[model samples]
Target chain A: MTQPPVIEVNGLMRSYGGGRTLLGREKPVIHAINDVSFQIAEGETLGLVGESGSGKSTTGRAVLHLERPDAGSVRFRGTELSTLGQQGLKPYRKHMQMIFQDPYSALNPRMKVGRFVGEPLVVHGVDSGSSLQDRVAELFKLVGLDPSFMSRYPHEFSGGQRQRINIARAIALQPGFIVADEPITALDVSIQAQIVNLFQDLQDQLGLAYLFIAHDLSMVRYLCQWVAVMLRGRIVEMAPTEQIFADPRHPYTRSLLAAIPVPDPDRVRPDRPPFDVAANVPPREAPLIEVAPDHFVLDHQVQ
Target chain B: MALLEIKNLTVEFDTPGGVVHAVNDLNYSVEAGETLGVVGESGSGKSVHILALLGLLPCPPGRIVSGEAWFDGRNLMALSDRDLRSIRGGEIGMVFQDPMSSLNPVLTVGRQLKEVLTRHTNLTGRALKARMVELLDIVGIPHPEARLSQYPHEFSGGMRQRVMIAIGMACNPRLLIADEATTALDVTVQAQILDLVRQLKHDFGTTVIWITHDMGVVAELADTIQVMYGGRIMERGPVRPVFHDPRSAYTWGLLNSLPDEGARTQRRLYQIPGSPPDMSNPPPGDPFAPRNPFATERCHREVPPLRDVGNMPGHKVAAWYDLPALLAAQSEKEQTP
Candidate 1:
């Protein structure tokens, strides 16, 4: 990326109230995301990978200010976002957008696809007349959808096509940075490749920096230049793509790498070693410790 | 002898739009204790084929266009609903993609297992309780005696999938149709589930129709792979040939697109250029012709039948061109991204 970092996150910390009542209700504080930090260079792709409850999705949402952080600061370009309240954040939202994982659930079923995609444009007072329709049509083409099909509902399209529409909506604003939360995870096997390629295309054409959150480790290695492996609300490892795959030192990272199915039938990978089942895992109770030049690991506690 | 044989099975669905030819004269088989992985993207009719065999398709919408699914020398397509019901869940269990929706939320996990057991066997009282605990243990659920009382939501994503396996194996079904069962799981959880399925096959001689989109996962689990496209089996053969050097252009595109564990030299991630052929108005030729980079005029004009590639026993491919060359080209194209 020729430009400077588009987004910088520092010492991010957030936890839900378990014992205390948020709305007079009891819930496991989830410890959703804690003390996470990362940066997205201009047009760079930073992937966050983990199993369920890893808090990757939470971290992405928090940076967009969709959720309040207990502690931390988020900076976009040269401006800081942590100081922005609802009123102050409204103007800056035009520069940022989010693409959710589930297209069907994320979209408003009751509304027309055009209205849903164009709603952001309208809210920002960007455009609303014939120009809005033109922009929407252009977006449809950009995302590999037929512009004539804009007069449709979310339910009308299949999983893959619906995802294309979701992509169109996310890129509608020409935002500087985007948070795509598992955008292609719900798609079909064949559809995943198309969606992934579309992301690459959009990134090149629009120069959009993205915080890509997903569970698919292989695609992450392909798509992102840098990656952060999250677990139980903290990043356990971070490094350049090649560095991480060549030698994953963290136990959690190794387990994640092992999870990816080897495509070659002739290949033999000794994935399941005799782990002393009771061996001590790194205690992630504290902050992440640097293990290598770029790689980092958290001492995560295991059962 | 093969445990299950699908002889030229074809299927059609009556949706509001029109009749969609879901499975076109598909023929395949599975032997006892063998796992046949069916690979395809969405709309490839992987689920529909399994649904037809299970007699679980929606009425008026789903009609077997022709052909039959034979198991143990009996034609399942000709069986009465009552007999089919006896086979389903009792003799052949199913596991779907999303574990969250597959299990009943209102009912405890034990109750669900008991339903299948009561349906298949005559076990009751102590025997039923004992069998339930044993099944739970086999699926690797911790503290089975205590978890029997817990509901689906109480378990994590991975644990819930284990419960699904326990339920699938409840009646000790001869065949298990795992339809995208682990697609929703994390890599670690996915590995655990795959290992469990493998163990199930080893212990029970359970033949499996493992439907998934992940090529990597299929390569790991399947003894043989059946690659489907546009509601048809474009390629069916041993996993090695189909995967090592794919014949079909669609299969090539899929393989090239995967994010592998190898060093990150994947440039553009070879993406299939066009969307899957519109099934609503599907054309006459190869369904993947439009999206295939190496597609020629002949590809758009004639639907290539699944042809035996050489006389190499069970190996087969369905392309009009050299598959290995096409795959190599696609692989090189992927490196450019």
Candidate 2:
């Protein structure tokens, strides 16, 4: 608990489609992510959950500096990432990597799986010749993929295997942090468990922190240590995984949790009135009020 | 007689790689007004069988080798293209997975609704316009009259799905087949669509064949559950029975593999060891035998017939080994440790 956090985000803001047009006509601004803040300690996972257009993915992208935030600071190991230009941020890119949702499209069809996995290492100029191949093979083995099949194209591998290839590529440089945006969402149910297990295994072995962004709350509850609930580009609730599931305070959080369809047939799901987002819009400057130890909820009452 | 009965249905696809046995001897029946949920991973032939029945599967590659799909005393498989077209949107409606691709981008929502109504019914002009608006209203779309003129791209993802559902319900079809209908939507939006479908069933007594990979969704919406794997029915029974006590190892493994509320306590989820079966060259005996931990010697050599479970009525499974007994023993071993 006392260890320095791996990544810390503060008052992060990012918007799209704003500003005056050529004719001086005003363009409506859409805040993809607004005033988002969170921290991920060493080897700890922070589950970011929300419905579509809630900016969960944008927050992840902003944290990794893949999409630069319009405002606020992203400190990766106490180094501010927002201020650093592309050339300056090159060194830090290896320490923080991202795994996207679609396994099919994330991988290049033309490239061999071995070269794809080893691409990061090659870019970073870490290893060469037989060593790079050996590293890629080791990475593949770590993700529970057969090292011999590295020569095959992306089409030859299954969905689960393709994801493992992506993971192998992401972790080829042994990054301290990973932003896995809906990593398991695209795979089959049986394969999802395998990938989750792999994520856990990798984290344990390498002591990697993760910003696991997904809509599947059950998986989030199982894998993540902390959970953050986002609604309309703002985090309405932030708490420990157990607290977020068991004692959600925000109406949006409660509605989000209640919406998850339980696997059991006998259990009667309570009829919860849907949270009307249009009616109750969380203000832009709403402060995150601490309700419990390490648990925070946005103060919706403060107009 | 059941409302719709499928017997010995086998579907194949001819490809350069090999002949893909998409659906292997699939046999099942759906009673009138009952919700039958078809659960399976991709390439399990859950969608293909329905497509074949509707005569939607493309020729040259997809071939329905053998089967008889009897719907309302008529063999749907043997029906002519003209007859099938009349039955498709008239007597039997279908809601596909992707609303965006399924809907026409250029046409207004009202036009799309009118197209279905006009093809199936004798409604004209004002009556057709009124029916379109009513259908949209039934699907819980706000400002139906104003919304009708809007295009597919103009609507949100959830609203677009609602429009698709409205189109499916336009003909007042006795049977509705929704293939992974809510899989693409957000959870809250999915919940709303599920409620809308349930409401439709309640009001009109519509029989539904809900196809999806999510067991949770099946548990919530379906009265009966049919678990499919490797293009074969692994298990079928009432929702409670199949979920609580599955006879097939594949079904058991699938239910256990999900990271449900119970799974939260455990350090790791119970993974069903290997990948899904390759349909092109499936194993000789049981397709799921490779991943099934409790597969017997007989399972590796001969395909098990889908037979009724001894104790449970209406419950059927295709497996050689006694799954319940094996699971009991496995649990007992873990308990002792």
Candidate 3:
């Protein structure tokens, strides 16, 4: 536990569209992410879960520096990245990569599979010529894909296979950390297991840290050791996966857990209050209080 | 008589890849007021079967190869387009996956509801206006009168879906077909819509056909479940027995792959080994045999027929393996140190 964190984010904040409108009136600003802070240790998976518009995706992007935040600092391997210029941040880009939810739109359609996977290495000036082909083949094999299909286009592959390609691209640079945003949501049940397992295997083999952002609790629990529940751009609860599932403190977290339809017909879920009731309540000014060992809950008094 | 009955229904789509055998020899029935949940992944032919029943499949590329769809003592397949039109919106209601695309964007919510009311009923003038407001209120939309004047774009995603539900249930149809109606909404909003559907079913005794890929949603809402894979019904039975004691290996795989929130087991998920078969040219034998770990020689040679599982009434599975032998083998495997 004494090892330094792989990525550290402190008091991160981001907003969208506060400028004047075409009618010369001021437009309303949407605080997409507010005062978010988290740490991902080396070779660990940290899950950020929330529904649409909860800013979970924004938090993932902000940490990876894909979308710059308006305030706060992102420290990667003890190096502050928030103030780095574009050229200064270039070297750090290879240490982190992102995978998106939709595989169809993520990859360029016109490019061949080998070219797409090798593009990262080419850009980084790490491998070239015959070595690039070898590296692409190696990546394809690592992700459980057939290396012979390098010449095929993305259209020829199914949804799950396309996701594997996305994973291969994310790891092509051998980054120490990766941010996966809803990586398996678009896949089928059988294929989801394949991708999720591949992620675990890759993480162990490469000693990679992951920031897994998703909306499904079951998948998050399966893949992550620690989970942070976000609501309306704020972290309401942060705990180990077991504690979050077994003993959720926040009312919003409890309702979110209850809303998950368990796949057992004999056990019907007891009705709970609508989640918005808790979301509509104002946030407490108090800081996150540790209720149990390493389990933090937002100190908001519920009505 | 059952509200709707289908036997040996088959549909094919002439795609560039070849003729896709979408629905093959599908047989199922829904009672007057019961809810039937159809579960399947994409390209499993669940949606196509419903579209075929409603006569919505385009003719050139899509053809009802052969089948008899009996609804209210009438063979729906034999009915003319003119007859099917009335049956579609009058006796049968449908809600689709995307609420935004289903509703007319430019039309005020009231006009759309009034059009359906006018087409299927004798109400007119103030009576029509009053009925429209009542329909909106029944679906749990706030400020019903104000919502009626607003366009579809003015409402949120959940509200638009509620409007779609109101339009579908406007005539109090005997059967309601909802195809992934809540897949687009957030979990909280999905729960609300689900609760609303359950209430409507109780109040009006409306038969519901809810099709989705999520087994959790099916478990929460359906009284009976029909699992479809590769254009065929793998298993169909009462929800409780199907979950407790599955007869089909495919169903077992589907259940095992699902990550349960209740118990966090320290084991790898039981994944179905391969992808779903290409439907354009389906294999000669059972479509699931390639991926099924428990597949037998018979499964690779011939298609399994739906038969009753042991003494459980109304439970059927299209599998060659006996349930007792599979269960015994499974327990033996588990017991091994």
What TM-scores do the predictions have?
0.91, 0.97, 0.96
Candidate 1 residue pairs that clash: A282-A299, A282-A300, A283-A299, A284-A299, A284-A300, B267-B337, B268-B337
Segments in model 1 whose C-alpha atoms lie over 4 Å from true places: A1-3, A17-28, A108-119, A127-141, A146-158, A273-285, A299-303, B296-298, B324-337
Please state the Cα-based DockQ of model 3 relative to the true two-chain complex: 0.67
lDDT of 1 by residue, A1-303 (tens): 356999999888888766757677766665778788888899899999987777888898899999988888899987999998799999889889899988889888888898888888998899999999999988988988888887888887878888888778788778989999998888776678788888999999999998999888878888898889887777878888888888786777777787678788987855653222225333435766677786766655321
Better of 2 and 3 by lDDT: 2
Q: Write the per-residue lDDT of candidate 1 for residues B1-337, one digit (tens) a residue.
A: 7889998888888878888888888888888878899988767888988898878888677888888899888899899999998888878888887888888899999999899899999999999999999999998887999999999999988889888888888898898989989887877777877888888888878989899988888899999998889888888888887787677777777887776567766666666675566576777888888777777888889988888874446777777888777656878989999
Residue A133 lDDT in candidate 2: 85
Per-residue lDDT of A29 in model 2: 95
Query: Native-contact recovery for every candidate?
Result: 0.78, 0.66, 0.61
lDDT of 2 by residue, A10-99 (tens): 999999997899999999999999999998999999999988889999999889888989999999999999999999999999999999
In the order shown, the chain A TM-scores of the predictions are 0.91, 0.97, 0.96
Q: How good is the docking of model 2, by CAPRI class?
A: medium
Better of 1 and 3 by lDDT: 3
